[model samples]
Target: MKRDSCQQRIYAVRRVGLAIDRAARATSKIDKRQAARWATAWGVACGVRQF
Candidate 1:
């Protein structure tokens, strides 16, 4: 089945979050939880609800 726009956007945001998380892990800058929080914040700012 085809996903909706919002789902696609969320998936993109998650991909970004994973990238950030991986980069941070590589550099030991931050943890996965922090990365997830940042992604959630971005999503909320972009008006993506249902979190």
Candidate 2:
């Protein structure tokens, strides 16, 4: 008789929501977008799995 092993995979999700004050937060919006872009780029460069 033989035994087999299996691997499990997990994923992380980020949910961004919009608000009514969105019209007054231009700088904040830009900053958030820049951060997200950098993070994804860095992850890809480092071979990080993102969902």
Maximum-TM-score candidate: 1
**Model 1, stretches more than 4 Å misplaced?**
27-51
User: What lDDT tens digits, residue by residue, belong to model 2 across residues 1-51?
Assistant: 542321111111111112212323546777667656655554443345356
> Could you tell me every candidate's TM-score relative to the true structure?
0.49, 0.42
In angstroms, give how far residue 24 of model 1 lies from its true place. 0.5
**Candidate no. 1 TM-score:** 0.49
User: What does candidate 2 score on TM?
Assistant: 0.42
Q: What is the lDDT of residue 48 in candidate 1?
A: 59
Error at 40, model 1, angstroms = 17
User: Per-residue lDDT tens digits of candidate 1, residues 1-51?
Assistant: 998877877776776666566646754445666675666666664465445
Worst 10 residues of 2 by lDDT: 7-16
